[model samples]
Target chain A: MRRLILLLPLVLFLGVAVFLYRGLFMDPSELPSALIDKPFPAFSLPAVEGDRTLTQRDIIGQPALVNVWATWCVACRVEHPVLNKLAEAGVRIYGVNYKDDNASARKWLAEFHDPYQLNIEDARGSLGLDLGVYGAPETFLIDKDGIIRHKFVGVIDERVWREKLAPLYQALVDEVTP
Target chain B: MKRFAAALLLGLAALGVAHAAIDTFEFASEADRQRYRTLVEELRCPKCQNQNIADSDAPIAMDLRAQVYAKLEEGQSDAQIIDYLVSRYGDFVLYKPPVTARTLLLWYGPGALLLGGFVLLGVIVLRRRRARGEVDVGLSQDEQDRLASLLNPTPSDKKD
Candidate 1:
């Protein structure tokens, strides 16, 4: 017992050291979305490419990716081609033009081939706010019922899609179709 | 050069003032304004992470500040506003996280450690005092005789 007592400080030091060591590699920016498994927030906003309004109901029938993006965010430009590639392979993607000018958004979509099936023009970021969007290039995986399943923050390159998002997306698609 | 430097400083100060003035809102009362200020200061910016929404210049932070002001004007209580943000952003938005099962150790760990330290100190002190008490008992017979001899030496020892 006395020997164990003498080792107590060393044990505590090791425990704390191990905990802090693990914390050093953890990404602080990756905030878990509070809306996972919850239905997407309701919104009635204009489409970027057309005069018609887009809403949560329009996205409810399919398993899709709701990608929050803006023209001002440089990372979105980096992630755009990958998104285009994914869309070519028939991945349903909906874009939220978060806090961006509609004209600029339209120009960007035109300049760089558009990947989104429908783009929600959230010029004031009201829908973004409702979705708890803090930054651009955040992609959310939604199930067929418009329920958010997972959220990936920052730029999604090809590897991230294949390794992390693809499996989840495929699972949701299979569950809905089968 | 000095004049130019002074002009640049003045320009910068004016810019700062303009930035601060951009979010001005019409409050129904002074109390509501105060509440709004407090709420913004307490709510952490989800984008910037460390800064409160009031201090951050991030667009999301600005939106949150506007939301806080709107909610306050709509007569939402402080708790209601906090709940609304927490529901969207989780407890990370609040500077003070509420006590929960996961946070139980974080809330009470330091106090428990301090209490344990005091208890260990008390035990060590008590043991030391007891050890010293044992040492303070009367000397053995042989040691007392040696002490007596040293204190009151015999006449022969004195002559030597």
Candidate 2:
């Protein structure tokens, strides 16, 4: 008992060291979305390119990636090619043109081949606010029922898509299709 | 010169106060304005993790501040406004997280650790004292005399 008591401080030190070591690799910017496992928020926003208004109902009946992107966010530009590739490979992608000018957003889509099936224009960021978007280039995986399954913050390169998002997305697609 | 410096310092201080008031919303009452200020200061900016919404210039923070002002003007209670943000942003937005099952350890861990430390120290001290008392009682008269002689080292003993 006395020997065990003498080792108590060492045990406590090791526990704290392990905790801090794990924390060092953890990304502080990757905040867990409150919307996960919940239905997507309702919105009545216009499309980026057309006059038709887009709503939550339009995004239902299929599993899709609702990607929040803006012309101002440089990371979105970096992530765009991967998104385009994903779309080419038959992935359903929807875009939230967050807080961006419609002209610029339309121009960007034209200049770089548009990857999204429908781009929701969040001009005043009201829809983005409803979705709890703090920054651009965030992606939410929504199932066929419009339930948000996962949220990934920051730029999604091919590696991120392959390693992290692809399995979850495939699972969602399989669940609905199969 | 001193008076001029003092006036300049006062002007700079006034400027600092003006900078903190980032928005000019028309509040119906002074109470509402105060509530808005408190809410912004207490809410953390999601983009800039360390800064409160009031102190951050991030666009999201600005939007949140506007949302708070709108909610306040609409006569929503403070709890309702906070709940609205918490629902979207989670409990991370609040500077003071509510006590829940997940956060019980965070709220009480330090106090528990300190209490345990004190108890452990008390036990160690009590055991040490008791051990000393036992040693004192265990010594025979002959052993006490020998210990005293070794400690004192009388003249005859030193000569040997």
Candidate 3:
């Protein structure tokens, strides 16, 4: 109808408005992970401040958090307290000290309150690259079966921990040996 | 001021040392090397969003390039290598999206829209012709000849 043809521009405008509204609500920084439901990538890394090496096996046998951080990353400092709180509550937090000088990483952790069970020295970022890590302060949720359950990019805070991760963790976290 | 300049020089020197980027690969043949170039240009950089792996200097781009090189050396086919990355990084990593159930609309929607437009235009013209009880598809040969005469009468044959 002629009337329908006249109304086409309005209909298109409304459709575009709705699409732009939805776009405004989307998190531009959040990238959908492709490592979900896959086993954690294997790597052997030495301690950040010690001589012993820890492998992928060390992270399994418990539902744990693996945080990739660096001294160069300012956001890692922002999420330090949240990580410390989680660690204090008996959540075993693993660390991948990504591409930072060994002494600097050790010093930063010491000053910021070390929350990790044992930090891995990824000085060359080899393990970080294997895990598809491009930026720092990326956290991964690993189940007792050694599978990567969730990967969160950017700083993990209390709200993010509760809203995005906790419900999934409660459902997927496997039995841990005491 | 002297101290500041000295520190700046030191920092620049440190950066130069830190970022001595050396991206090298040994290909089995010229054909394989060409394929490697094509594949990198086609693969999207996850961190850089808009850049292909070949053009991006993002750390993820570097990692992807290294992975591609390693896969090539391991004698893996390009498809297998791409599949391996897709399994980890999703189809978003590929610049050329696959035609799947999810991407069916993306692949064909524009073409369908163009066809629909053509059909609609044809229908509108036909309906207008039918409504007038006459068709004006185009001017007939005789009508065209008449139009030409009317626009420019013969020079000598024109009425005085």
Highest lDDT against the true fold, candidate: 2
lDDT of 1 by residue, A1-178 (tens): 9799899889999999999999999999888788888999999999998799888999998999999999999999999999999999999999999999988999999999999999999999999888889999999999999999999999999999999999999999999879
Q: What digit string (tens of lDDT, one per residue) describes model 2 on residues B55-141?
A: 899999999999999999889999999999999999989999999999999999999999998998999899999988877566788
Any runs in candidate 2 off by more than 4 Å, and if so which?
Answer: B1-19, B131-160
The segments of candidate 1 whose C-alpha lies over 4 angstroms from its true place after superposition are B1-23, B137-160
Whichever of 1 and 3 has more DockQ, that candidate is 1
lDDT of 3 by residue, A10-115 (tens): 9979988998999999986567777888898888889987789889888888788899999888999999999999899888889999989988887898888899
Recovered native contacts, candidate 1: 0.62
Q: What tens digits encode model 3's per-residue C-alpha lDDT throughout B29-125?
A: 9998988888998998888888888878887788889889889888899999999888777887899999999999899989998998999899999
Compute the interface RMSD for each candidate structure.
Answer: 0.7, 0.5, 1.9
User: For candidate 3 chain B, which ten residues in a row score worst on lDDT?
Assistant: B17-26
* lDDT, candidate 3, at A160: 94
RMSD of each: 5.8, 5.9, 8.3
lDDT of model 1, residue B33: 83
Which CAPRI quality tier does the interface of model 1 achieve?
medium
